[model samples]
Target: MAGMLNIGVSGLNAAQAQLNTTSHNITNAGTVGYHRQTVGQAARPPLFTGAGFFGQGTDVTSVTRSYNQFLENQVLQADNRRAQYGAYSAQIGQINNLLADSTTGLSPALANFFAGVQEVASNPTSVAARQSLISNGQALASRFQSLNTRLEEVRQGVEGGIVQTVESINTYAKAIAEMNQRIVVAQAGGAGAPANDLLDQRDQLLAELNKLVQITVVDETDSGKANGAVSVFIGSGQPLVLRGTVSQFQVIPSAADPQRGAISLTAPGGNTIEIAESLLSGGELGGLLEFRLVSLDAAQNELGLIALGITETFNAQHKLGVDLEGVLGKDFFKPIAPTVVPAVAGVSTSITDVSEVRAKDYRVLVSGGSVRLFAGDEELASLALAPAPAWPATLTGGGIAVSLPGAASIPADGLLIQPTRNAARNIAVGISDPREIAAGGPVSVTSPLTNQGTGKVANIDIRDIAGMDGSGDGVPDFSAFALGFDGTGPALTVPAGFTIERLKMDAATGEWVTDGSYPSGGSSTTYTPSADSSGVQFRVTGPGGYTFDFRFSGTPESGDAFSFGPSVAGVADNRNAVALGALQTTKVLGADASGRPTATFQSLYAQTVTTVGNKTREVQVNEAAQESLLDQATSARDSVSGVNLDEEAANLVRYQLAYQASARVMTVAQRLFDELISIGR
Candidate 1:
């Protein structure tokens, strides 16, 4: 009877515990990160019987939380991927809109400015038209400046975003560390009951942390405290947390760029180490860094290329013309001195030629006293990095200049050098006066009417020569001389383009000027015409060796004369203006290191727009797909671990019935004991 009563009491206790667990599950069904609790039962030691062993009573064993490690890990990974793409897609969309918009973008400004150039070419003497050209040029410069400002604003915003993300990650890391401490204390004894709810809370914190920065989690149960816990790491095994001890991560303003924030880790000895930007990936911070480093940097550099190409090429052409002031045309566009910024981690770079600059950030890897350059994975150049000791090192041909300082300066992972990164913002108009516009070529050439021949001279240009000077008076020199090709007198066998035929000279100053007659006994010089000259050349030695050419097309008499004249001051000369307008079709934007032409300005700008648009489109599609995957992963995890209220409700009813049956059993045992007692009495 006593044994019967004890068995009934154990059954009652088990039923009561089951009811309590079911009630707890149903009440916390909607709780975030909650896992359902389950109770396990085992039969106590069975009493020995003659026939077979009979169970003494049912005893409750461990209560476990419904969880799956693989399913939970799947959820975490999916969340990280989705967050990274979503973040990147959100930020890159701004640049896409900026470059593609016709109203405020670079296309309209380029078109209107070129149109202004053509207008001036049509009416070279019109002050009103020149003024319009200046206005259009100013508008274009303003547009470049404005676009640069907007991009900087975007970068600053990204910097702020980075700081915020690091702070959140730090908060999560600390909280997780605290939870680890609590869990270790709760489960001190081996085989002690697990703090399931506390584990859920810690896991929830980890899920949130991974969204800001992707991390590698190590189960610390065997390592940290012999209790169930995890350690977290990020970016190539940089430890973030070690059980109850956490390493602090922080964002500090970059020394190279004050507007940017650098990520760092704080070691236990109060030492802060800088984290390389390349090591980070797979979360919101990763996405922002990608935008700042790659997308934003490339766009700014591409914009700079247009500004630079126009600056160098247009100014080169502009200098070939004469201004309305009867003087040489100065630079119409101010030069943006190539930025040679040194990295905080010990590397420096500068652009050697604006025409050859590409929209890419190059990496400078230094190792074994030699350096290698890479645009991503493609190796652009590699050379010995030993100190030049004489000249500035021209790395990777003459396109980029690099410097490696002392022995310990180079980082093991190298550095990134972005030369044209800030070009557009600093560009502005160099010449503001409309009268300074060069609209006329510096020299003129023609044929004399006395020459009864089809021979012709065309397109004479004054090429640059050191120490060359014009007359002190503001008026251009208009000396007239003739290319007298005496075909009968001397049957001179000479190079057709440059010949030592009978020479002539005529100048106000008779010192080495062309006068159509050689000195009495002086040695006559040769003539070297330009390449397009058909069969004749007229060369002069003075003024750094000026040369002109006549296309000796048909038969010439004994003395066929071609005439030369200096340009008139402030006249309607549109040769230079027309050349400037023709630059619209010139392949001046893209030039490789060896001076090979690639793309024009129009095509390069279009490529930039297309690249940004494609990246945005790709991210949008991938984000949508990742979101769907994340949702599916969450559902799968929830099915096994998540609590269901309906099931718990049915469990409550079943446990109550078991409890009633156990109470009846106890009552029957008491009645049997009472009957036995009565019979004994």
Candidate 2:
């Protein structure tokens, strides 16, 4: 009877414990990260009987919380990737909006500016038309400045976000460290119960941290640590948390860019090592760094390319003509100068002219012997590193004059120099005067009085205009042609460096006629030609850089002579404007460092717009995928660990009934003992 009573008591105690656990689960059902608790039960040692061992009532063993390591880790990864793409999509959307807008976009401004060019070309002597063209040019420059300024604003916002994210990450790291300390304490002193609640909270904090930066975790329990602590590392195995200790990081400006962000972690020895941006991935921090390093930088330089190309091409053509005042046309637009960015700290750079700057970014690598240049991964040139008398010594290549200190050593990855990053910032009009417009070509072509033949020369126009080489040699190299036709052809003295090419025109597309003209259809008659007799195209090649083209269509007499000379000062010729307007459709943007044409300006800009739009859409799709993954992970975790109120309620009723039944058995045993005592009296 005593044994029976003891058995019932044991069962009652087990049932009471299970009931308490059920109540706890029910009350915390809405709590995040709360795992359902279960009271484990096992039958006590069987009582020895004559027949055989019989089972004793059950006793509670241990309370365990359900968990799955794999599911939780998956959730963390999903959150990380979702954050990265979300940030990237949000940031890149601004570029798409700016470039695709009809009003503020570059396309309309480019078209309007060219329209003004055509108007001036149609009426070169009209002051009103010239002034309108200058206004349009100014407007175009203003648009460039606005777009560049807005992009800088986005970069600044990214920097600010970095600061905030770093702080948040540090805060979470400290909280996690604190939780680890409590967990170590709760797990101390032999066969101790796990601090399941503390672990849950720590996991929650870890998920939050993953959103800011990707991290890898090492649970010491799996690695033979006594305290079962967790260690967290980020970005190429830099430890943020080691056991209970937390390390802080900082964001600093890069040597190559003052406003650029470089993440650095303070080591245990108090030294700081910079983390390469690429090594860090899978969160908002990764997204911001990637966008700034690649897309944003590229967009800004490309925008500058437009500014630099227009300024350089227009100014070069403008200088080749005479204005209404009969003076040589000076710069109608301010030139963009080269910019040198130092890869090493304390080094500097500069440029000489806009024409010297290309649209491509140059990577300057230093060696023991000399400095090397690279466009992306391709090496373009190298210059012997020399000592500087002037602060930044000049090394010219890749269409740029890069000024670097002769004494500075290049960093391992090299200096990234972008001469056009700020090209659009100060793109304002340099010429405001209507009379300053260069409407006439600098050279005149006319027939000499001595020509007795029926031979006639077509009107000559300048192509391939080069800036005055500061050699006082922009003068026309043409004199009266000693014209005549022997049985062979007409001959004249051709100077060196003078070029001849056929013209190619597309009237339907309105592209300017190219200088690649065809060979003359008619063969030379009784004349000695300077060029091939079969090819009636004769060109006076000059030793100077002066070049212009014309064609002859008639038979030349032996004594026929012609003269091509410098502008007879003050001719109201709109010939230069006509050629200048042809620049409206010129392919000037996509050029190699050697000045080879690739794509037109319109195509390049369109490509950029398409890239940003595509990137935005890609991020959106990726974010959605990541989000779906997160949902799946969360569901898997919840299936095993989440609290269920209905199950808990059922457990409550079952445990209540078990406690009552055990109490009733003890009462019955007491009643039997009382009856025996009464009968004995």
Candidate 3:
């Protein structure tokens, strides 16, 4: 009876443990990250008798939670990726809408500005038209500034997000470290038994941290046994949490670009390292970094490029015309210069060729007596400085000219060069008065009435007005000159400061053949007129960089003559305005490999809009796909580790029945004991 009672007591304890485990599971079924617990049991040692050993009742051994490491890791990875794509899509969508909107975009402003130019060209003397043009110019500049402001706001928002995300990551790391301590202590006190609840809490914290930034987890072992501690690493093995010690994360300005924010990690040993943006991938932080690097920067730079193109090209052409007062036209728009960071004393930068400018930032590195200029990671130009620093030395590359003064010393940390980054923000109209608009060409041409030939000067195109000012005066140095054609050929009586080149068309090939060149001081070129000689073309050049192309068509008699001179008080002439209006369709924005313009202003802006729209669409699709993947992965993980209410309820009934059976056995044992005692009495 004693042996039976002991066996019945052992069975009762085992059944009680199973019921407790089942109750615990049922109670915590709604808890996040909670795994169902199970009771482990083993039969006690059997008593050895003469015959076969009698079996002893069961003993409760251990309780463990159902968990799978592989499935959990898969869930984490999928969640991180989904978060990254979602963040990226949210940020880029704003830029897409901003650029693609017809009313708010640069395209409409550009078209309206050019339409105003056309108005001015049509009515050169109308003050209303000129004032409207000025208003349109101002509006265009304001549009550019406003667009840049919006982009800057987005950038600031990204910076704020980065700061918040880093703070959350650090907070999670500290909490995880504390949880590690609790789990280790609890497991140790439980005599090698796993602390299931504390382990779940730590895993929950890890999953939360992974949403902010992707991380890798490693189980910490003591003497080859898992001590319920883990080490967490992020951004290519940078330790974030090590057992009981937690590292910290900080947001700092980037070394390459101070305006941008970067992530830094501070180890427990007092070492801090800035993580490269490219190394950090997945999660919200990665998405922010990537969006800033690829989308935000590119959009701003491309907008600035368009602004620069408008300013440079328009100003160049405007300066070649005469205003209402017959004075030379000043700049139509203020020029934008390259921006250099860490302002070096006696160093200046300028844009020399707008066509060659690319939407990129540059770096100037000076080390070992050599100065190297880099556009991104590629070296553009390298020069060795002289033992004595050269004064007024110019380094030209990527359409920008960097000038260094004699006293200019190379900065040890190098300089950052941004050619067009600020152009959109700073662009403005240079002229305010409507009458200051240059609408008349500087030079005019006419045919002498005494000419007997049907030959007449059909067109005179200004090649370079700056080249025409040979007398060091601000005015173009054009003089009265006549080109008379005799029956044998055409002869030019050139002025003292003028040089001319003559060309004739070959009938067979239909190509112009250079006849001869006449130098200054009245030189003559002989060419016999032929029936197949289409016409005569003359390229006349004057001092002070002024040049023009003159084409003469039709047969010229012996005394046919044409003259050229500067236009005086030519307010009614709209030749320059016509030329300026042509800029709308001109391919003057981007250049090909051979340095030919490939895109008009409107076309380039359209391309920018298209690129942003495509990127936004791509990110949205990726986000949706990642969402699907995350759902699948979560389901897979939950299938193994998640609690099922129905299953837990069924377990409760089964464990309860076992407990009753054990109670009945114990009751029978007690009754038998009573019988024995009664017999003994």
Best by TM-score: 3
Best by lDDT: 3
Q: After superposition, how far is residue 593 of candidate 3 from its true place, in Å?
A: 2.3
lDDT of each: 0.75, 0.74, 0.82
- Report the C-alpha displacement of residue 304, candidate 1, in angstroms: 1.5
Tell me which of candidates 2 and 3 scores higher on lDDT: 3
Who is ahead in lDDT, 1 or 3?
3
Q: Is candidate 2 or candidate 3 better by TM-score?
A: 3
What's the CA error at residue 207 for candidate 3, in Å?
1.1
Q: Clashing pairs in model 3?
A: 466-545, 467-544, 467-545, 467-546, 468-545, 468-546, 469-544, 470-543, 470-544
lDDT of 3 by residue, 276-351 (tens): 9998889999999899989999999999999999999999888888888777788999888888886888889988
Model 2 CA lDDT for position 298: 79
Q: What's the alpha carbon RMSD for model 2?
A: 4.9
Q: After superposing candidate 3, which stretches have Cα over 4 Å from the reference?
A: 367-369, 386-389, 406-408, 467-477, 484-496, 502-538
Give candidates' CA RMSD values in order: 7.1, 4.9, 3.5
